[model samples]
Target chain A: MTDPKRPRDPDPLADDAFDAALGARLRAGREDTATLSAAVLSRLAQDPRQTPPGRWLTPAPMAAGFAGLMTVAGVAGYLWVPLFGAGGEDAILAAALGGLVPGGF
Target chain B: MTAEARAKGASEAMDALMRGDRLALSRLIALYGPGIRAFAAHQLGDASEAEDIAQEVFLRVWSEARRYDPARGAVSTWIWRIAANLCTDRRRRRAVRRFLGLEAVPEAALPDDAMPGAERIVAGREQMRQLGPALAALPDRQREALLMRTAGELATAEIAAAMGLSPGAVEQLLVRARAGLRRTMGEKDDD
Candidate 1:
């Protein structure tokens, strides 16, 4: 834990006078407030916030959705290939030849 | 007005803004423009770019107002966070530009002659000339923490929230920034 009061580094401008002087100097160089405000307001008026409700459907979500779809397809293929052979040709023939077996009575 | 009252007013304004009230946005800019501009100018060391960044920050607020949750923090904190992020983006873009040799590195603009008084203006300009290099020498986060603390008059907790750091971390950044400035200024004074 760092001590709040510890003088880790000596600050020559630790006094209030230096703080005030620095603040004033920075403020003096500041851009005109009214001008900046007007520019901001004008820009805001020109390009009003038109964020759509579906803005959250960004690329990440889209990519995730695609991956999920691919995973489901892959899982279905894996199950199907094992249950019905690589092309399911034998299963198709068996279903079509139902009751036409050579030894059927 | 008390801090509570000011915050209440800001909350109301934000609510109005979320409800598509342009007047609320104008009011927000009126209230927070100077501080935002100062933060940008100090961080970027360029007045024109600061103005551009300030404009971008408010535009973002207008767009993102509905996402704001007052329970999380004040409107000022939200706004400063946007300003800081935009300034960082601009700095990164400027770096890329300079790396590609497409643009020269920008120097902080000297104080304009249109400043009201002559004598005081000259002295302030000299002070800023000294202060600019000292400020530019500090690391980005340290410079940012110090400027937001001092120029923006933001509380430590508010700054921490804006910078996504703990209050203690923000204080340490401030300390280091001040120490770095003092050393740089001392070196300048010696030469």
Candidate 2:
């Protein structure tokens, strides 16, 4: 229930003019020529379309697909390979078991 | 690519960026930097600082785009926050300078009106100096709520998305922020 017509407090943004002035000064300097600013921008864009490395590649499905492939490859290697001791001291069961369920000697 | 296709192409480009496509990042900047700079100019309130801040924001965006989560916020809002954060940091640095007594008050902001140009700037300066504390005193959410409302020209829904507030909450925040500003500025009274 405050007075709608009275000066509410003192205008917190009354100094918006100061920010406006700062904006004005900055723009005034640019008014003479846009060439320098343009050049500066161009310098920043020296490699206009060159993407830097380690960025997320938008074709994200490829990265996902690659991950899937790695997973499959690992499982296949586990299932298909004959990774066992040539000197058969109960090696077949041992390799198949992979350090699990000790083979009876 | 047609216009829609071009945008789709850009979406793919962003994906490529996500895929570690080094050039996509640069392409994205080339496409969006100017617009970002223009917005930054207005948002930061000065071009000299705006340019540097814009560059810093974009670099941070590039470095962190991978962390962007749609569930958390819109990509645009994420970028906006980077820019806003940089501006706020600059403000903090300036405040620190002023705090150490190293910040000299510009003569134009002083009370004495000796010269015409100085006199003009003085009024503006004095008004701002007076207003600064009040503006600073406002709740951060209220102040940022106002900035979000004005700067982005965003609808309440969009503001809600960017700020992670409910739309209703955003509207209420805006109401309070405006009322707060009005109260602080003495809009209820005049000299």
Candidate 3:
């Protein structure tokens, strides 16, 4: 939306003088040299931009993928790792029973 | 985007800000942050208070950035208006504290060296101290109008919009602000 009240440009001399006054104020706002302003800039840069350290096991995407893989691995481990002493390929077949049941022999 | 990029860049940045892009928000903060800080610092006569106000201003920007529309004014102007409003609010609160005879004012005004690094803050503070008397001597309206205009680098139009005055009034205020500033600094021209 338009502001509907933007100022008309000032006359040339007025504009120049205005600029000069402002320049002084801005320059005056400047402090020391080189690494002068630790206070304000430090404060300004304190936003959470990216790669936030601490908390959560991973970025949410990776964590979700990891959880899925871990679940599948846990199921495979349970089937193959001799539950009730049902070791070896028998256990493997039982674990794989969801598919490839190979009809009538 | 340079000027070459500013149009495309600003448009994209505007969209990014609306979409809550953190980087865009940071850019917007940087664009107008210093001006806001300066205005706050000058208004409160203390850098610590100014920094506090600056952070508040940015937080408000982060929250309200989605509402900003580039067609109205540059993001810079829009943000400064927010900052100015916040500073004015704080000034009111300060007045209340002072009235209660309970607010213990700081011994010396904080220096504007609130920016990062330790470079020239001392010199800057010295200048502020040297100019403090001069700055205090001006009529309130002239001082505020000059500081708000120059420190923010606001064009007269944006200044008018922020101050709620006619552009003609702004021009008059600005002219008086400059003359007052020159007189405050003990400068005189033959012409």
Best by TM-score: 1
Task: DockQ each candidate and list the results.
Answer: 0.25, 0.03, 0.08
lDDT of 1 by residue, B1-191 (tens): 44466567778899999998878877787666766776787787887788778777877888888889988999989998988877887777677778999987677745556588889788877887888878988999998988887666677899999999999999889878877998999999999
| Candidate 2: share of reference interface contacts reproduced | 0.00
Give stretches of model 1 more than 4 Å off.
A1-20, A29-31, A50-105, B1-6, B111-114
User: What is each predicted model's overall lDDT from 0 to 1?
Assistant: 0.76, 0.54, 0.62
Task: Write one digit per residue (lDDT tens) for candidate 3, span B29-109.
Answer: 445556666677777776778767776666666556667777787665666677767666677767787899878775334
**Number of the top candidate by DockQ?**
1
Candidate 1 per-residue lDDT, tens place, A56-84, comes to: 34446679989999999999876776776
lDDT of 3 at B110: 41
Tens digits of per-residue lDDT for model 2 on A4-60?
A: 887655353643443344333222222222332344345446753444332333236
Candidate 3, superposed: residue stretches over 4 Å from native: A1-18, A21-105, B1-12, B107-122, B187-191
Assess the local accuracy of residue B114 in candidate 1 as a C-alpha lDDT between 0 and 100.
57
Candidate 2 whole-model C-alpha lDDT, 0 to 1: 0.54
Q: How many clashing residue pairs are found in candidate 3?
A: 23
Instruction: Show model 2 residue runs off by greater than 4 Å.
Output: A1-105, B1-13, B16-47, B104-139, B164-168, B182-191
All candidates' TM-scores? Answer: 0.73, 0.44, 0.60
Task: Please report how far candidate 3 places residue A52 from its true position, in Å.
Answer: 23
DockQ of 1: 0.25
